[model samples]
Target: MTIAYWCVLASCLLPLLAVGYAKFLSSDSDPKNYDNNNPRDYLAKLKGDGQRALWAEKNTLEAMPLFFAAVIIAHNTGADQATLDALAISFIGFRLLYIYLYISDKATLRSLSWFAGLACCVAMFIISA
Candidate 1:
């Protein structure tokens, strides 16, 4: 598969990292541990970085369909392979930065990264046209 295609796969899995942080790394290990049976309840109780991580996971998931469509449409419609790959990489990089900034509670930078990532998706669609 192309790098852009591989990036799609990577994008699919990226939420795991945030959810992992929210579920495992952020919580106390005792009675307040990750609740498999009531995961949402457990997650809802998180604050600060944990809550931000959960939000990051949710936001990433929400962004995926547009990204998936952009990459696939760009590929099928013959966007320049190298350019598509670069944009795909940029998207991933921006998303990674977004997640980190979110978890770190850097609101302004996180919004910038989010917008940058969205721009990459839009670029993919435009390149295909």
Candidate 2:
């Protein structure tokens, strides 16, 4: 309903999007290969952009819970909605940039973008109180 809520949705879905891209580009094109539960086996054939995409997707998933919890805590704790919305948008923006940087092999910029997204998550808590 709110921007923060939508951002949460976006955050939840972004990793899926990244992995979808990676899977589509993987050497194993048949969807049946995905039956394997081992991540190493599932992604063993990925290389270059595909490998980077997989890593980015995993990183985004790892970060998802923190952002989700942070945004919800901020909203429930009566943090300013406008500020929460801004931070939510910033988190998404930075994450998108982080994915792009990673896929493009820009390690330094990707790390900076990662920090910015994490900062946005931290700011949600800071602003809540």
Candidate 3:
């Protein structure tokens, strides 16, 4: 697989990994440990630090489609490998950094990384267009 393909795969997996990590940290080893009594109960349990991690995970997952679309569109438009690789790498790196900073409750750093990832997507979109 090409570097771009690997970047896309890594980008997609980052959020799922974060969510798994968060669940592991919060819940006991038992898979059935989550309380299903109240809907908010589960979400509330993920508050503060856990909540941030959850949000970051959610955001990363949400961004996956747009990232894939941008890359695919770029490929279809005959975008150079270098440009695609650069954008893909930037998107993956920023997304990973964003998740890390968010899980650690580093607001400014997380936001910066999020913006950088978004900017890479925008750059790819523009080039593809």
Best by lDDT: 1
Q: What is the C-alpha lDDT of each candidate?
A: 0.92, 0.88, 0.80
What residue pairs clash in candidate 1, if any at all? none
Kindly give the stretch of ten consecutive residues in candidate 1 with the minimal lDDT sum.
Answer: 26-35
Lowest lDDT block of 10, candidate 3: 26-35
- Candidate topping TM-score: 1
Would you estimate the TM-scores of all the predictions? Answer: 0.94, 0.87, 0.82
Candidate 2, residue 4: CA error in Å? Answer: 0.3
Error of 1 at 72 (Å): 0.7
Better of 1 and 3 by lDDT: 1
- What is the TM-score of candidate 2? 0.87
lDDT of 3 by residue, 41-117 (tens): 56556666667777888899899998998888888898787988898998998998988898788999888998899
- lDDT-based ranking: 1, 2, 3
- For the record, the alpha-carbon RMSD of candidate 3 to the native fold, in angstroms, is 3.1
For model 3, the stretches where C-alpha displacement exceeds 4 angstroms are 26-44
TM-score of 3: 0.82
